[model samples]
Target chain A: MHGLRRVPENLSGRGDKVMEDKYDVVVVGAGPAGSTAAYSAAKNGARVLMVDRRRELGVPVQCGEAIAEDILNELGIKPDRRWAVNRTNAVKIVSPSGIEIRISEKKVTGKVGYVLNRKVFDKFLAVRAVKAGAEAMIGSYVNGLVFKNGRIGGIRGVGLDGKFEVAADVVIAADGVGSRVARWAGLNTALRFDDIETCAQFQMVGVDFESLSMLEFYLGSRISPGGYAWVFPKGDDLANVGLGVLGSRAERRPIEYLRDFVSRMPGLSKGKIVEVNVGGVPVCGPIEETVGDSLMVVGDAARQVNPLTGGGIDSAMRAGTIAGEVAAKAVEEGDTSKERLKEYERRWKEAMGKRLTRYLKAKEILLGLSDGELDKLAEVLRGVKFDRISLTDMLKVLVKANPKLLWKLRGLL
Target chain B: MEVDSSLCLRCGACVSICPVDAIEATDSYVRPNERCTDCGACRKICPVGAIK
Candidate 1:
């Protein structure tokens, strides 16, 4: 039991553990957020280390595999040849009545995003981090934090063969939704039932499509209450179709809703499911704050995913970059305490936090709307034709029934 | 089968996000089982991914 401080398994006498490794920073988890954070910090002259409990990084890939192109540019990371399944120029919004509208008009600047190959994509990001001089330790399970003076010191974890301890000046909690790192560091992240989106997804192989270059989003209460269903083409006649319902209203299993949705839809139901994947996305605004002494949180851990659209790859990458930079800056100033690290919270909020707050409020208002109201809103928008309907203007009309929403609608419009 | 008590801040993020509700908090740890679909939602939504 070397290096294992607090043995979690009820195994007898597991506390007598010890391995010695050290770094300027240690990041747990090897998903997009973690890899990016590790890469950024290591590139900035920090002795960084990253770990993942899984034997492999990208196996059993669990994401919708949708990512924005612009985000890739900001990170100076290019999508490798093996990571792209298909490219799309537009995203079609389909109403409950089956009305369809294409939101992109041009070629380069159109609604552009990628349907990725997660196996390759996940590995690609981590490899970049390694290339930047960060050490990657796979199959290492981080069991707890090592603390000193009530400040975060490092992580205590185990591998397939042995246990180890890695001390660091800071820890970036890019560990994802069930992140224990943030809580252990003394930050609060409890979520309400209504704030979560329980999701179910299926990878279908035999689906024939009218169009393969565009992603389709279906909006209707009969299908997904307080959420929407999506069809993202993954090529080779395959597509990833899924839906998310508010956790509080999720009475039945997510698969049941997904099955009903695909079977009823004309184009989607024709295919057979080759793979089934289920997950959840935190569609709320950021936590009250995501920084504490000697620690910071990023990606889903920070609750930066868009509540309305449930898209997070772009935002998570953005958050990872911020966390990495702030952690490095904190080290430079020799202030690992939470008070000086508040800049991360402030900078993140100023950059993307404001929009997330608005999006969360908008989602609450949108979820409360009735099916008839949605149909009416869709109809009104159809009546008011334009090359592209301004989303803010359209939302204003949709939220007219709620005065509180109206009051909050000033700067948004 | 093992949960870091220090990591489990009792945020209930796992309880709320688990598709099958397999995660339940005892006085000390959050427990799950074969009933869990391994959707990884709890893992993903976990502010710390502490479920591992």
Candidate 2:
């Protein structure tokens, strides 16, 4: 009531078709998280149904298209050659003063990481879910949640065929950032403007670059201010050129920032914009909670995005795997109540909460840095002991390893 | 969708999802552009209760 709104919740659908009546679990989205959740649940023997609003899955790609190689391996997903467009060996960070430093290869998950073909990767995940025995449908949009006795009873929505209503013992709200499912299930998914980072990107063709395999990062208040501009090369002649601006620090629209950034870069300036994509990122880290009666939230709906990198594909898949497993367990136990379902929240936190907490703090500190400070940071990091960001390392261990390489990071410790 | 200046968290959900791309989000606030067409896409998709 203070800063939120809701639809009446009654106008979902008519229960006419038997196929739309129910399932053991219903996943709300078909993106990586949702699809992964459905796959995991179905694999564990849960009767699962996953629906997407898009007719063609993974079209209109809405991502930065980068994932850590280590995470992919950790998740037991074999890298698909067809879905990997480019492989970058290192990350090249350019400071405000034009000082370029390569973040150590050892620090990253792999010596080479792939730039994904999201169109293929997203579809790949959804198809996997279907193959795992989950019923997958596209062109179906979830309109509202059917609540009974203060619990999530079912879902009501529409599709190309007609109106549909499906009851389910468990619901997985794997919908993305603007998820209506979470709200309908009584979760307050409101993010503050300041907590959101405005983002815009262009898939540019005809670009000239020194390193076709280097993942390039440009930093400065003028360049991206509170966020970083990236040139993730798909090839020597093409790249995904984009920037995300911290909502509070952006003086102009995100598009304007990217336009100015593109104009100033020699290679990028000469490139033609093939496609433009814009989005918002909740940088405040994961929401306070992720579970409710007969329901669980995953992926962007739960704000599982990395506060620093704006990367959630790995984390989403990780959470989806956990949520699906837990949901299936609840169904097997014949208890879909919040008490029984609380394990999903517990398991997700155990798997992802710690890292997200660290990134949230890191994002705040990173935002306060000036160009000179960032340059100094670059200088300090040049002496790092390892190649990775050490996201899980204790603050003292990071500083102790390279005493003079960084600035006064005592606060971070 | 109308941003409730006092309530709007400026999360950019409405701005990002506007089908016709009408909303513009700056650091301070979010507003509709000339092309808004009052399609109400933003109102339906805003995560915060800000849009009405």
Candidate 3:
């Protein structure tokens, strides 16, 4: 009710009457990033409007639905039973030769892991944003951006009623991997084939798992070709079976790879597919720039996904909080220029930039490994009890196990 | 560019990777506009092999 109110006909010389609204901040896309940004901005006293193309906040789910509990704690969110379907504390990594390496909580930064019901979790986050004084518009598609003297000023989009415009001091682009908002704002956000991982997933019922509270990852070229397959259990007999293949390495569609993967896995082949989700993940790490004059990009729009795991919810939420806080402060100071907004970029980089870069390098190394080498690596890691292993420690173990890998992995050391 | 609607998932992967901003995605469908350069970027990124 606070946004997109009716306006007089042809107020700006357009033939059709357009509804208009104004806010201190306008967030495109109401996913984790957008909702979190809205919540943060509003909490910091900024008049904010959050919009999403979906009529519902989290319908036709696109994520693997796994999140670390540390992120929730960091965001000060209490885990609700309605959204936290299953709690996992271990991750099982399976090699091509069927060797399994289990990583316990000690190895993970978070004490607990959760496979979320994103439909509920995402909506809950949006509702929280609204409750914190942000306005939300659903079923709205942002088609264009309003620019003033080469600086982003607002957004133009179609809502359920009709064409609408929302002028804002700052616009946060949290529009996911397929985002055009940043590009429209003069940022070259185009992703290369090598930087993207085309993914396919199915929410399945009646699948079998050794541990309902364990997340499974399968690694091998034959399985996913430069990416990996995952099974995140939502319940004892249900799971999200998915796989991602690097676009540059893919010979067939990701769906075909997913089908083949599901068909071959004894535990998954018997399951019934309840939902199909597919999308492209930007595994290129964070882009060169995420902030422009009056514009800030968060979430997948800014390529904030982890290169090695293809996980983004954590990064998105963290960046969203920072962007929201910065946007609000910048607006309060009456300076939403790129220089003022650079604080958001600096803070987020300080938080996760080095880790992302290291992961990207690790991903490149993993892509160069043959299935046999992966098996050997897994063999060396199998049954090893790790109190706490950082990336450097993991690399050291690998180097010790397979001295041949020393030269290839010395860069990481 | 042509989309085989039967296989298209409306996931917008093609829209994100297009350097030309040629793709448009609605809730029900996704299509390539005249700005398309036939670079096959969309086809390569399509998860279901829907683009032609």
> Residue-wise lDDT of candidate 2 within A122-233, one digit each (tens)?
9889778877777765667677798878779888877656778888999999877767677767777765556677777899999876687688888999988789999998
When sorted by lDDT, best at the front, the candidate numbers are 3, 2, 1
lDDT at position A162, candidate 2: 76
Q: Per-residue alpha-carbon lDDT of model 1 for A1-413, expressed as tens digits?
A: 11122222212222223223777778887788888888887777676777776656765555678876779877777666589778876667778777766655365445457899887887788877777767777667777799877767899866655778888998988877656677667676655667777677889978866577777888887788778888999996799998887766765655678899999877788888987665567787778778888788888877778888888778887877777777877787788788887887888888788788778877876787777766666765554433332467566654664455465455555
> Candidate 3: misplaced stretches above 4 Å?
A1-20, A106-110, A388-390
Worst 10 residues of 3 chain A by lDDT: A6-15
Cα lDDT of model 3 by residue, A293-405, tens digit = 99999999999999999999999999999999999999999999999999999999999998888899899989898999889899888857765424676688888878988
Q: Of the candidates shown, which would achieve the greatest DockQ relative to the real structure? A: 3
Worst 10 residues of 2 chain A by lDDT: A2-11
Show pairs that collide, candidate 2: A4-B49, A5-B49, A107-A387, A107-A388, A193-B9, A193-B10, A380-A405
lDDT of 2 by residue, B1-52 (tens): 5788875655447744554546655334578868788876565444334677
Error of 1 at A116 (Å): 1.3
In the order shown, the candidates' DockQ scores are 0.10, 0.13, 0.80
**DockQ category of candidate 2:** incorrect
- Locate the minimum summed-lDDT window of 10 residues in model 1 chain A: A1-10
Summed backbone clashes in each candidate are: 19, 7, 0
